[model samples]
Target: MLLSALLGVCLIPAHSKPAGEQLGSPLLQTCFEEAKKIVDDAYKYSREESLRRVRKEVVRPHDALRLLKQPRGGTRSAVRSADYMAQTLRLLQERVHHVHKRSLNVTDLLSEEDLNKLSEITGCASQVTFPSCRTTPNLNTYRTANSVCNNIKNPRLGSSNTPFARWLPAEYDDAISQPKGWDRTRRFNNFLLPTGYDVRQVSNNILSTTDAGVVNDREYTHMVTMFGQWNDHDLTFTPFSPSIRSFSNGINCDESCEKIEPCIPIPIPPGDPRLPTGRNSCIPAFRSAPVCGSGYSAFNFGGEPKKREQINALTAFLD
Candidate 1:
């Protein structure tokens, strides 16, 4: 996530209105506008440098193609030409990954603002209000597209289980054919799952699918870049690296709601379809989806308000 000036200190205004009024105020609108500006600036800074490098790397393939176009010169075969193309593609892939990673870091921060606005926009509650961000599908476009899909259906498909059956592929094709629809689709799926499936389901089905187009390749590469950048940033921020042995007894995660009411440890089934099976699945049992805060319909990661004291103390180095 892009570091923000609003962070580490509360900016609710000392004379902040009641949560109800604040919910309706244009503050969130302004927040999103500001966040978007930040994201655009970040992109502008990174995109030029990145694209230049990419074009340079791609020149290898271009040169190989040019060489192949000429008469084989009777001296040497064009075997090395194909090899050059392959290497160029590989390098271009890396360049895409590197560029996309930097871009997504900007997005992670933008998502934090998006989540905050979700409450104000959608009026959904139970959304956590922390400066955290995660990239996923844009719900506005999803809802609109899904609505259009609902209107069109495949007559031949008896069961709705077929992946294509759920979507108005032909209609979507028509829609995406239009400039507006294509732009929307690109924004909606900037981090889109290939095969036009739901973004959440992509993780579940990536192994099953074989079509690894540039889009899918870029998505995976960008995701790794974002995750890696986050890891590095998180380490820098929370550098107090205590070994597990420091908590040999157990983690004293404070005595608040859990200590007072006790955390309800609901047992989940081991073989639930929700979980990953087999030996290599190092999956967690549960995860939460984003929701709106109090007013907006925008998605929030988790609804917990940031603990100012904790964040400030952790970020004291800024002083």
Candidate 2:
């Protein structure tokens, strides 16, 4: 009984035959004819509506009115859309219908050679089928970044797909593999050239101090970390907050923090939330530092009280 039941299940038909092949069934033929008629009418109405709008826009006022007034197909001046009429006739052709039905039997899209070529281009290790590799959003970027990240030695410097791959190109992956001279730090400008952006314009736009090429250590660190996070990691995927303290001489300097460090502390007026308020408030703290003089001189913080000369020097700089 079990063997008989299994045979019966295997013998069952999965798909039905086309309407044309079922001519013996009168009911099926009648239903198919009705469906074809409905489709024809829908196609006709859409064409007619589109042609009517185009006719209104293209013809002169008098000619349009004459065409509208005349009966269709009489040659007096009937409104006819040649493009739509031609399309409708072609679709309704017997040969086109036969070709459409035959084309549906095709399932496989890629040939063996095409498959091999794609695999070679992508460097995919295992054999992959076309259907399985259907294009998905951000797949290209992820693939490129993944390949590049695999070859890189330094885990921190290497670009990752941890967050998301935006518009990553194959070149970026290939470039990352190439040796970039003695410097280990990944500089995007050195390896990857930015498209659409003017390099000189970008450099000029960045606010630089009088010591043009020299940047404080904190700024340098910040710039490196920021580039690694933005370009390499794809900013969207990075988990950390963007706010970075790029100065060593921050208010929390409790230990022996007297030595010269990067990041010039810009003294804002009192009540600015950036400065810490002690027993004397932020005003006294800001006032303590000797005012900067004309030109870009180093900030003077000698153990001297606020002097009249120092205040005048700052005022002159401001002017």
Residue-level lDDT of model 2, residues 71-136, one tens digit each, is 222111101111122122222232223534544211122233432322232222121112232343
The residue-by-residue lDDT of candidate 1 on 60-95, one tens digit each, is 442333223322221111111211222222232233
Candidate closest to the true structure, highest TM-score: 1
**Prediction 2 global C-alpha lDDT:** 0.26
The TM-score that candidate 2 achieves is 0.15
Runs in model 1 with CA error above 4 Å?
1-12, 18-21, 55-319
Pairs of residues at least 3 apart in sequence or in different chains that clash in candidate 2: 163-237
The ten-residue window of minimal lDDT in model 2 covers: 310-319
Best candidate (score: lDDT): 1
lDDT of each: 0.27, 0.26
